[model samples]
Target chain A: AQTVTQSQPEMSVQEAETVTLSCTYDTSESDYYLFWYKQPPSRQMILVIRQEAYKQQNATENRFSVNFQKAAKSFSLKISDSQLGDAAMYFCASSAYSGAGSYQLTFGKGTKLSVIP
Target chain B: DAGVTQSPTHLIKTRGQQVTLRCSPKSGHDTVSWYQQALGQGPQFIFQYYEEEERQRGNFPDRFSGHQFPNYSSELNVNALLLGDSALYLCASSSHMRLDQETQYFGPGTRLLVL
Candidate 1:
C-alpha cells in the first residue's frame, strides 16, 4: 500500500509572506500522480495543484507551486504571497495512473496552515 | 454547468442506527467516488461507482455500502453506525475522457455526527 506523509502538523505564516508545507510519499509504482488539496472552513475540498511522477518539471498554479523531488519521494507545496484566504488545511495525495476507475486517492495526514494578519 | 452536490448537508445519528447520504454528480459525468474525512485529518477513499457498479473500494468495512442510480447519482449508507463513523463525507465526480486527465471535482461534504 502507498502512504503519504505530511511532516508539518500546524503551520502559520504572516499575511503577504510565503510558506511551504512539506509532504512525502512511498510508492512502488513508477507511473503515479501527486496532488495537493485545500479544505477551508466551508468544508469543501479544492484541488490546489498536481504533479505527474514521470514529469520532471514541477507544477505551478497562480500563487501555488509544488517542489516535486521524485528521487527523494518529496512533494511539497509552496504558497507564495499568502493571504488570509489561504488559511486552511492542506493535504497531499497519491494515486496510480490507471485509465479507468482510478479514483482512489491515498492522502496524507494533512497540514493545517494559518495565515496571520 | 452545475457542480457535484451532496445532501443532507448535516446529519446526526446515534450508535446502532442507519444513515443514508446522497450525491448528485456533475452534469455529463459517469463516475462518482465517496470519501471519509475525519476531523483534523485528510480524506480517505471509501469507494467509487461507475457504470452503475462498484468499481473500486478502499480499506473501509462492509458497514459502509453505496448504490449508484441510472442517472449517475449515488447514495452512501452506513448501517449500525459507530462513534468512529462521525466524520465529513465527501462525494466527487469525474468524466471519462482520455485527455481530461484525472480531474475529480468535489462536492461540499456532508457532516455526519454519530453519537
Candidate 2:
C-alpha cells in the first residue's frame, strides 16, 4: 500500500513571496505519479502540478513547481509570487502506473496555506 | 468543459438509512471514481467504475456499492449509514487512454451528514 505524508498542517506566506510545502510518500513501485491539488473554500479540488517518478527533472507550471527527489521519496511544492487567491488547502497525492491497481490516489492529510497581504 | 460534477450538494440522513450520491463524468471521460473525505482529512478512494463495472475498490465494506451508467455517469450507494459515514463525497473523472499519466479532475463534493 502506498501512503503520502504532509508533515505541515498549516503554512502561511506573505503576498508576492514564495513558499514551499513538504510531502513524502511510501511506495514500493518503481513507476508512479505524484500530484499536488488545491482546494479552496468552494470545496473544489484543482490540480496544481504533477511529476512523473521516471522523470529526473522537476515539474514546473508557471508559479507552481515541484521538487521531486525519487531516491529520498520526497516531492515538495513551491509557490512563487503567492497571491491572496493562492490561499487554500494543499494536498499531496500519489498513484501507481496503470495495471498495478485501480489507479486510485493516495493523498496526504493536507496543509492549509494562508497567503497574507 | 464541465469538469466532473456531483449532485445533491448536501444531504442528511439518519442512522440505518440508505443514501445514493450521483456523479457525471467530465466530457469525453469514460472512467469515474469516488472518494470520501472526512472533516479535516484527505479524501480516501472508495471505488472506481469503468465500462459500467467496478474495476477497483478501497477498504470499504460491502455496505458501500456503486454503479456506472452507459453515459459514464456513476452513483455511490451506502446502506446502513453510520455517523462515521458522514463526510464529503467526491467524484473524479479521467480518461482510460491517459490512465498511465493519471490526471484526475475532481468535482465539488457532496457533503453527507448522518445524524
Candidate 3:
C-alpha cells in the first residue's frame, strides 16, 4: 500500500512571497504519479500540478512547481509570487500507473496554507 | 466546459438508513471515480467506474456501492449508514484514452451528515 504524508499541518506566506509545502510517500511501485491539489473554502478540489515518477525533471505550472525527489520518496510543492487566492488546503496524492488500482488515488492529510496580505 | 458535477449539495440521513449520491462526468470523459473526504482530511478513494462497470475500488467496506450509467454518470449508495459516514463526497472524471497522464477533474462535492 502506498501512503502519502504531509508533515506540515499549517503554513503561512506573505503576499508576493514564496512558500514550499513538504510531502513524502512510501511506495514500492517504480511507476507512479504524484499530484498536488488545492481546496479553497468553496470546497472545490483543484489540480495544482503533477509529476511523473520516471521524469527526472520537476513539473512546473505557472506559479506552481514541484520538487520531485524519487530517491528520497519526496515530492514537495513550491508556490512563487503567492497571492491571497493561493490560500487553501493543499493535498499531496499518489497513484499507480497500471493495474486495477490505477484509478484509485492515495492522499495525504493536507496542509492548510494561509496567504497574508 | 462544465467540469464534474454532483447532485444534492448536501444530504442528511440517520443510522440504519440509506443514501444515494449522483455524479455527472465532465464532457468527453468516460470514467468516474468517487471519494470520501472526512473533515480536515484528504479525500479517500471509494471506487471507480468505467464502461458502466466497477474498474477499481479502495479499502472501503461493502456498505459502499456504486453504479455507472451509459452516459458516464455515476451514483454512490451507502446502506446502513452510521454517524462515522458523515463527510464530503467528491466525484472525479477523466478520459480513459489517456488515463495514465490525464488529470481527474473534481466536483464541488456533496456534504453528507449522518445524524
Candidate 4:
C-alpha cells in the first residue's frame, strides 16, 4: 500500500510572494509518478505539475515547480509570484505502476493555500 | 477540445438510496478513473476503467461499482448509500497508449450530498 502525507493543513502567502506546500509518501514500487493538482472553488481538479521518479532534475512549469527528493520521499510544490488565483487546495499524489495497468493515485490530505492581495 | 465532463453537477440523496454519477472522458482519452473527495481531504481513488473493464480499484467497498462504455465514457454507482458517502465525486481521464500516461485530466466533479 502507498501512502501520501501533506503536513500543512493550511498555508497563506501574500500576493506576488512565493509559497511552498510540503508532501511526503511511501511506495514500494520501483517505478512511479508524482503529481501536484490544484482545485479551486470551481470544483475541478486541475493538473498543475508532474515529476517522473526517474528524473533527477525537478519539474518546473512557469510559476509552478516541484522539489522532488526521491530518496527522502518528499515532493513539495512551489508557487512563485503567487496571485490571488493561486489560492486553492493543493494535493500531492503518487501513482505506481504495479503491472497490468495499476496506475491509481495515492493522494495526501491536501493543503489549503490562501493568497492575500 | 472539451475537457472531461460530468452529469448532474449536484445531487441530494438519503441513506439507503442508491445513486449513479456519469462521466465523459476528454477527447482522445481511452481510460477513465473515479475518485471521491471528502470535505477538507484529498481525493481518494475509487477505480479505473479501460477497454470497457475495471483495471484498478482502491480501498472502496463493493457498494461502489462502475461501468465503462465503448465510447470511453463511464458511470459510478453507489448502493445503500450512507451519509458518509457525501462528498465530491471526481472523474479523471487519460490514455493508456501515451508515453506520458501518468498525466490524468479531471472533470469538474459531481458533488453528492447524502443526508
Q: Cα-based RMSD of the predictions, in order?
A: 1.4, 1.2, 1.3, 0.9
Q: Give candidate 4 regions above 4 Å deviation.
A: none
Worst 10 residues of 2 chain A by lDDT: A95-104
| lDDT against the true structure, each candidate | 0.91, 0.93, 0.92, 0.93
Task: Please give the ranking of all candidate structures by DockQ, highest first, separated by commas.
Answer: 4, 2, 1, 3
Tens digits of lDDT, candidate 2, A1-117: 899999999999999999999999999888789999999999999999988898999999999999999889999999999999999999999988546345779999999999999
Q: Is candidate 1 or candidate 4 better by TM-score?
A: 4
Tell me each candidate's TM-score: 0.95, 0.97, 0.97, 0.98
**How does the DockQ of candidate 1 come out?**
0.67
> Tens digits of per-residue lDDT for model 3 on A1-21?
889999999999999999999
TM-score of predicted structure 4: 0.98
A best-first ranking of the candidates according to their TM-score comes to 4, 2, 3, 1
- Candidate 3 residue B44 Cα shift, in angstroms, is 0.9
Q: B5-49, model 2: which lDDT tens digit per residue? A: 899999999999999999999988888989999999999999999
Instruction: Write candidate 4's Cα lDDT for A1-117 as tens digits.
Output: 789999999999999999999999999987899999999989899999999999999999999989999899999998999999998999899988856765888889989999998
Candidate 3 per-residue C-alpha lDDT over B9-106 given as tens digits, one digit per residue, 9 for 90 to 100: 99999899999999999888888999999999999999899889998888899999999999999999999999999999999998877745347889
Which pairs of residues collide in candidate 4? none
Candidate 1 residue-wise lDDT, B16-102, digit = tens:
999999999988888899999998888889999988888888889999999999999999999999999999999999877644446
Model 1: CA > 4 A from native: A98-100
- Residue pairs with colliding backbones in model 1 are none
